[model samples]
Target: MSADQSVAIVDDDDFFRKALERVFHSAGFRTESFAAAEAFLASYIPKDEACIILDLRMPRLGGLELLDRLKERGIDVPVIIYTGNADVPVTVQAMQAGAYAVVEKPLSSELLITRVRAAITDARARRTRRNQSASARAKLKLLTEREIEVARHLTEGLSSPEMADLLGISPRTVDAHRANLLRKLEIRSIAALARLFVLTELGDS
Candidate 1:
């Protein structure tokens, strides 16, 4: 983990939250602690955060509801939730709602450290993918409408003549648009163009 990246500990238990902060510090991680979910939500920005350690049972906005709120806001920070009683249904629901991992209370320090390290690694990978997708979308925006259509057809494995027939344009014009797509996207081959299209589409979900 980077020195600037801090783990966010959101739990109502002051003692436990402090203990977690200490543990993270001992493990060479910086931490930000909150006594309540609402307080954390109010001040938290998504950047420079490694992951969130959320308590499952809070007063107003519970862990699950907080997860939903994060999703609504399109925050992609990985969250690892802890609970005193982690039953099957609740664990399933938490996982479905985008909790990175669920752990029962009385967590071992070593286990916590290991899981947090893995979560941070996963969060970095997700950030990289999002950055790549954004770059792909920006590059795609430089293409004209006809060039975009040609790129789509290229991904579909359509020949220039076939795309021209379907688009009601001459094959020569289709080839021109294809060449322009390659130039504007700075790609050499049709395969790279297809990959760029897929990368741009990854952010849609």
Candidate 2:
């Protein structure tokens, strides 16, 4: 993620929230503070570019509940849970709910920073993969029905002659379709095309 990426800190305690904001700000991260989950959800856009620092306890909807809401909406931002209790069950539950980290309250600046950095890195990787998948889907949309058939065979590592034989088309036509698929996908080689196919499959699944 970029240095401009922000972190949202949601904690009911004013002192802790302000302290966390200061720490994040000093580390070159833009920070926002919300006293409750509802305020944060109402105010923030669910961008995959940002990370969320969530307090496990709050007045209205708790951190776990907020996490569920985000997941249901397919918002893939990274979340780190902060809590004073530090019980084993709570920690396990947070991790199971896809929290990047569960940190105890009276937080360490160093550990918190490290976890935030890791979460941002993970978020960026996921965003990149999603973008690549979108590109692949767009490329696939350019294919004609016959070209798509040829492309699928090519993605399965079939040679031009093999695809021609299987589809009962001329070798020259199969080769033409292969070249068109490459150009449409903006890929230089068959290996890159195959990778795009795999990525598209994974994205759909």
Top-TM-score candidate index: 1
- 79-104 in candidate 1: lDDT tens per residue? 99999989999999999999999999
Report lDDT (CA) for all predictions.
0.88, 0.85
Clashing pairs in 1: none
Query: If scored against the real structure, what TM-score would every candidate get?
Result: 0.85, 0.84
> Candidate 1: TM-score?
0.85
Q: State residue 140's C-alpha deviation in candidate 1, in Å.
A: 2.3
Candidate 2, residues 51-124: lDDT per residue as tens digits? 89999998879999999988887778899999998799999999999888888887789888888888988778
lDDT of 1: 0.88
Worst 10 residues of 1 by lDDT: 196-205
Off by over 4 Å in 1: 72-74
